[model samples]
Target: MPQARRKTPFSGKAKKQQLQSKKQNKTLLMSTSSGTTSYDVVSVNYQPTRGRGGRDTNRYALKFYRETEEELKIKKEEALKELIPVPEKDLEVNPVDYFPADVSFPKRPPWDFNMTPAQLDAQEQRYFKNYIDSLQASEHWKKMSYFELNLETWRQLWRVLEMCDILLLIVDVRYAGMMFPPSLYSYIQAQKKDMILVLNKIDLVPSSVVAGWKQYLTTAYPALRVLYFTSCPAYNLRGVTSDKAGQSNEDFCETILEKADTSFYTHERYKSGVLSIGCVGQPNVGKSSLLNALMGRCVVSVSKTPGHTKHFQTIYLTPQVRLCDCPGLVFPSTVPRPIQILMGSYPIAQLREPYTTIRYLSERLDMPKLLRIEHPEGDDTWSPRDICDGWAKKKGYLTAKAARLDTYRAANSLLRMALDGRICLWLRPPGFAEHRDKYESCEEIKYIRWVQALTSDQEEQKSDVLTSESDDDRHSDDSDADDDSTDDSETAAIANKFAALAGDD
Candidate 1:
């Protein structure tokens, strides 16, 4: 203590000094008011858009946002505003009602072949910025869900547009109008590229609805060619007894090619050249699945995840016909987030507030009947949350810690079923309901119904065989042999039917 008192300069405590860290001002030498940033620097001779000569870095570069608390609050309010329940009249919705009443998609920016890749990229970026700015300036964008923000993905679309002879604009049958961009159709027309508006996942809707949609689209777009396609077409072949019911994978490819050939040969570029058909659409619309089905093998990976296809891939189906699978590009649209999620445009796992979607789904379908769960409160009243909770209880989806009903898991499971076509909410085209009988009796509808019946019969036969095996296990050996013979005959008959469907003699 005496030594400390003598040595005051070496005391444990020292006076603190106030200091300000220097704030570096980032130079805005390359500032622009166009709302897009350029990666080229005149002084350094480095261009990020051009990238390193051999290595590409722009394709996967996603534009990110830093939202302030105020911006986030505004978004929350907007989202709340969009969660309106489906009206009773909208159960069989007109495709036109869901879209913007008076708005058109932005056209691609003008570019010539003479432009460099860097210049083209920059132009596209600028065009996209203006497009977004225009949308933001208007109140219409709020009606739209999230779209692809990455420039690289759009670049892929641009490449596909320029390279392909025929464009296969795949769309979900449930919401075909929502997926079909008028601007895209116009662009293809201007480019003189033939387009086939493919209505995928036909199994989710009735054949009448499918035929009605096809009729409506063709009538609306007089020059456009529309075709119905489903990777799982087996679901459509169940009931009808037509030669087409036994149509195989080859017939599928041939049907597609026949459509393409009819259009391709009509074009000026159709001279004995390799036909390049570009498969393009919003994500999770079965573009990759269609390609895989056409190829008769898994040439490209497919997932329920939107944008699983990262880049455009070309696969030659025949020596003369090649199909290009473009990565799913979410075109700008006025479709709401809930519809987008329901249409499989958005990933279910990343859904934040799924209750809104549940409400939307509930409004359209009998939730209790669809989910096969009774109301938890022992009454007819069932809210979206109640439905989720009841379903969670029924499915034994519980929280790990509290053992509470996991409504989140239940809601996601319901959404997955909707996406996987287990829970269908069919949206019909305009005037479809008025002439429902006409559509149901159309040749196309009958064919689809036949396919459905055939596939359903096959499924039932398989189930019966499995049940017979399990139930008749204690039976005599003779009974087993008889069962085996019956099964073999049924299997052979099914094979022959499928062979006939495949256009086999």
Candidate 2:
């Protein structure tokens, strides 16, 4: 330590310079070892071409001396790995975009009207010849089912519609408030063809309501010719049981025969030899049910679940009335998110509380009054459960344990009421009563209740006098002064006035 440190030749600046020299020498030695002479390597030059304004334009020139077979193979492999036809280095120009500046959009093909009277006689003769030739070549021709409204299905349906001789459009009266998809309806109208609008599920709604639905449809959709029908007629099933095979068979036969007789009277106009009827409607609107009822046999399977019918099935109803059952037509993806959630068709099932909708509908539709829920004290804040509990208590469904309300049973009772059509969710639009006097009437409600009772095996235990008294109490202030005097008139008149006061069912 006393000798003092001697100054070294490799100081801080010198050490850096020595390191940089070593790196350079190592690179040179490495290149030389690989037989790659720096002087033999080729160099590329970039140049710019002068324009009229003396501005230089960018361009590049590549110069190569020689490449080994291994290098060429490696380049080919690299190109193949990239899924390119050739190496990027070999490409001289960029691929041009093939998309046109003015691309023509697709248009709906025009309806083939070669057979229309407007065509020339010679053209008509030629069309007829071709038509007969095609028919002769085909194995068979059947009506298109309504289920083909999906994009893929619609194509096949359009083809069938083009070839068909007649189109029968079946509409549910219950869905009269919902508008038909314009594109589809317009296609039907463009055919300039006659369509028979079947007001199905008449047995579910009141006859007066059915009439109002029909009148509303007729006035709104003037292009469509409509007919009313209650596919299931009221039957006297006083002692019928599901276990009685023979009785059930007889009942089915009798029901069919009666329907056939009625059809002879009402559907006489559609008795032509080549009628093609296509049944369509929203899910669970009872499209398949009506078809099964009309067929008198299970030609198409019916289920309580909606969207069960996925394809169209065609059945012959006499040679003239060929019926085609389609999958229920729903607006492809236009169903409101909330409605879809409530209906349980949505994938996510966002519905946390369905009772909210039920309660709102109950209030808006005057459901408590419709079902005749009695609250002697005149309380207005009654919940849906309260109504259900009251109904259960009245119907004797009390629990034996704590004398608590049997709410689960009560809820079911409410569901049954809706299912039985005692509470109609859809109704005729406003101004309809003024233009058409076909608003729902009381006799119709009684008829619907009687039919529902027959089908569900639920007896009409509540006396008519009790129901009338309850109605009088509820609407006492609004009741007409001559109501008691009007009791002497026919039941139809009294029912009509009661229905008018009840609003649309």
The whole-model lDDT of each prediction reads 0.60, 0.39
Error of 2 at 328 (Å): 1.1
Give all TM-scores, in the order shown: 0.69, 0.44
Query: lDDT value for candidate 1?
Result: 0.60
User: Over the stretch 386-487, how does candidate 2's per-residue lDDT look in tens digits?
Assistant: 555555555455566987766555554454344334444444443544544435443444445433332222223321211222232221233342234433
Location of the lowest summed lDDT over 10 successive residues in candidate 1:
17-26
State the lDDT of candidate 1 residue by residue for 172-275, as single tens digits: 98888778877777778888778899888765566677888888888877879987766653322332222222234444443332111101112346447888
User: Which candidate wins on lDDT?
Assistant: 1
Clashes by residue pair, model 2:
146-326, 147-326, 147-327
Which ten-residue region of model 2 has the weakest summed lDDT? 257-266
Error of 1 at 99 (Å): 4.9
What lDDT is reached at residue 35 by model 2? 68
How close is each model in CA RMSD to the real structure?
Answer: 14.5, 31.5
lDDT of 1 at 280: 92
